[model samples]
Target chain A: MEKSDEALMLQLQTGDLLSFDTLVKRWEKPLLNYCYRMVNDVALAEDLRQEVFLRIYRSTKTYRPTAQFSTWMYRIATNLCLDILAKQRRRKETPIDAYLESESDGFDERLIDPSGAPDAVVLKKEIKDRVRSALARLPENQRVVVTLRHYNDMKFHEIAEILECPISTVKSRMAAGLERLSKMLSEQE
Target chain B: MDCRFFREQIVSESYDQLDADAKKSLKAHLQTCRECEQFQVSLNETQQTLDQWEEVDSPIDIEALHDVIQPKPLSLPPQLPAWRWLAWGVAACLILTLSLSVLAWIGVDVKWADRGLTLRIGQESVPEITEQELVRLLQAERHATQVEIVKQLQGALDEFSKQLQVHLEERQKQADAQLVLIYQGLQSQRVQDLGFIRQELQHLAGATEAEFLETQRAFEFILASHVSEIQKNMK
Candidate 1:
């Protein structure tokens, strides 16, 4: 049995370090993963994650849990990401791995199983490459929406709450995102 | 009334955010229309590709988050000279005194709120270098801002690297290869540009004429490949 995020967050409000730790344990991976995708830079993503936690820590006393815990957390993360996006708007964008021919992000080729099984090795590498490329095609909003709905298993309404948009907008972003990917995949072959 | 309603419903069905009455009418029409039936397949395929991309698994790490929460020790070592400690104590007092004075000058009611959102004020109060940044931002057609949108792309790239691992895992969903490729390309550009920009922020901000020229050249590269370019050209 797990303590609900609401319960954990309430404990955090009292300056309970352990409770905050529990909340962190529950959210860290997903939060980190979300930040990573949202910012697309490892350092910045990590920085953003820390920033989010710092925010949560500060707001803990003020947190009212009016919405779902995940929703609130995401709201903070999204706002931070959006601000970063706004700032970045002033400069030129360079896609990661554009200059380097290496595989994207930080999973070097070693992620492939070295079992000496050629096909399996090739299969894993191919999967990695394809997944990387598929993610790249999505708009930031679409990418976040897809990740939230499909990966985190959030409902459209919940995603709406998280994104602070109308539920219809979340659905719209999701639909368009999916539509865009489906068209791209069709062309890839 | 007949075909147009059906067509609108067909597209709207993909979102399913439609109201129940609309859904019911749309479903009824979809059941009867051959053209709509075919259209549904395409829509479903598109929906499926997006869903699948989310399912694909990627390598991700979770514990790295622990390091983010622990507050660093801010205390000085015990062996510091008495004078140094006294100086530090005096400096801390003066800083606190000055900050409080400033807050009092601003008024406590507003000061507390401002404290929570000082960055917003900073942005508002600060001046942009000349009118160049604004001019560049305005001239962009939601497409041409890439040259001046360095920070945005850098943040995007940073996000890509952080999320790439998760992307591997979330990608377990079944998807069409071509759709994935284009999605990847767009995402890659976002990620790459972000990385490029992050590495060059201050450099771009105070860029020499030569550097600005270099940035403009990079924008040309993006202009060559942006999806919006295709959209604009087609129009």
Candidate 2:
């Protein structure tokens, strides 16, 4: 049987290096995707993801099993993202999509449309770009709420814990974010 | 029964956050309220639209993280492979035997019958000296000196590599520590920013509270006065 995260964590705390490897393998992709959407930059997201695991490895000795391992992991990852976003805010940098087009060719090529029709392929690409742009335009809190809700499939309470906010606030942000996204998608269509 | 309550439930129900009681109420309301029913349809459509945008699944480069979690180096010196050491010892023995044979061939009395080297020169013994024996001794001394020099160089190289690795690790740790410090500072600043916003909202709420009540009272008085004036004019 696969070990539980808590079990792996316990093993890691006892200095079993393999447990750390196992944990990293299990979480690296999901955490990378989470950070990508959070920061909207692939390279920055990977850096943040690495930082998340580095922090986890360092803290394993003091890690408490009181909460689910995912909760703690998300808290660390989201906080790192928020810090990056805050710094961007201070710098007054433009949104990622502004320059994303220059880099989009390399990335979007990976997401190939299975259908061979040129029209369908183009349509899919347009919708994908629109969704990303709309998501990028959302305020940070709402963007995070929707991303956690849809992409991570985290529970409202879990998201609340990660964001250090109330469940109602999470739901509120989700509602507003969804409504805006729906409107944006419709307009694009 | 009200559309407002049902509207709130629509979004929550879509998220699977609605309680059974609230869900039942919303379902009943949906059966009668065309507007809210349309809203439900739109919300579901929105969700479907979102579902179309699949998340990009990119692999993480884990080598960076792996470096941090990797175990420290063992302190013991690396030993040469047993086979290689055995080969070196055999070659050295062969060289020593070859030199002894050369001494015997050169007409000097040489004995190496397991008690180690012994030699005689010109039958006077000459303190047990032979020219080939002297040459053999010199060659053996040179080989041993070369081996010692190689070993010392190898040790120095190992030490240099270890120190380089340690310095690289120290630099990485320092960079990580600096990043963490910056992250903490940003987090605190975010908290302060939130607190400041909350305080401003509270202040706005206080300032608006009396104005809201006073406006309500004034509006009611105006309606009453207007109604009486209309009645008088009608009479």
Residue-wise lDDT of candidate 1 within A1-189, one digit each (tens)? 888999988887777777777777677768766775566555576678778888988788788978898888888888898788667655655654451234343543435556659986765555444544665557778888877765566778888887778976876677566556656666764
- Report RMSD for candidate 1: 48.6
- List lDDT for all candidates, in order: 0.68, 0.84
lDDT of 2 by residue, B151-188 (tens): 99999999999999999999999999999999999999
Question: TM-score per candidate, in order?
Answer: 0.51, 0.59
TM-score, chain B, model 1, is 0.24
**Candidate 2: residue B143 Cα off by (Å):** 68
Superposition error at A142 for model 1 (Å)? 2.9
- Report the Cα lDDT for candidate 2: 0.84
Which window of ten consecutive residues has the lowest lDDT sum in model 2 chain B?
A: B59-68
